[model samples]
Target: MAFSPASYSQNQPVLDALSRCIAACEMCADACLHEDHVKMMVPCIRLDRDCADICRLTAAFIARGSDHAKHVLRECIEICQKCADECGQHQHDHCQQCAAACRACVEACQQYAG
Candidate 1:
């Protein structure tokens, strides 16, 4: 029983957003580590990691049609928002991109949860 998101009508958007967010967060975190003042990006890096992990878990829950998906989505939204806020504080290209991705994920998750 291979789980395919295509079988779930409304999950595609949320899944797409989550995947994008995960990629963006990972990239941002990696880039932040390379910045000259890595110390300044501690919060952003932490949030990015947390957001990516939660997005991955949320995507899995959604893909499996778990009863707890909604609960997990609520947490995902919170973390995504926090990550976005932290990323938005930075002017780096990756951070800005990550912020946009996180915001998109939040919107998608909210719609899916509704």
Candidate 2:
């Protein structure tokens, strides 16, 4: 299914954070793939992808005001934190940016995760 951020007008902060996190995750993954030691970055790449997917789902569910949005948010925050931690271990610019974005996303998702 196709998802559109334009449809989500409320919770602007959360929406924006989620969007940023997705972009960061994608960029981090691509950067990881291009690294000389790609094998060593497998975990970071996996976490980035997982965090991005959960963030996207959380935004969609929240936009729709789904009853399960909180559940998704809970998972999203956890993955965001994990992704940030993983990315923080790397010294690449993409990893650093992704970590920062994921941290911001974690804060944004906290309110709704309750």
- With a 3 Å backbone cut-off (N, CA, C), the pairs that clash in candidate 1 are none
In order, what is each prediction's RMSD in angstroms? 2.8, 4.2
| Model 2 C-alpha lDDT per residue in residues 7-28, reported as the tens digit of each score | 3554677989999999999999
Q: What is residue 107's positional error in candidate 1, in angstroms?
A: 0.4
lDDT, residue 15, model 2:
88
Question: What is each predicted model's overall lDDT from 0 to 1?
Answer: 0.93, 0.89
Residue-pair clashes per candidate: 0, 0
Q: Which candidate is the best by TM-score?
A: 1
Candidate 1, 113: how far from true, in Å?
Answer: 1.1
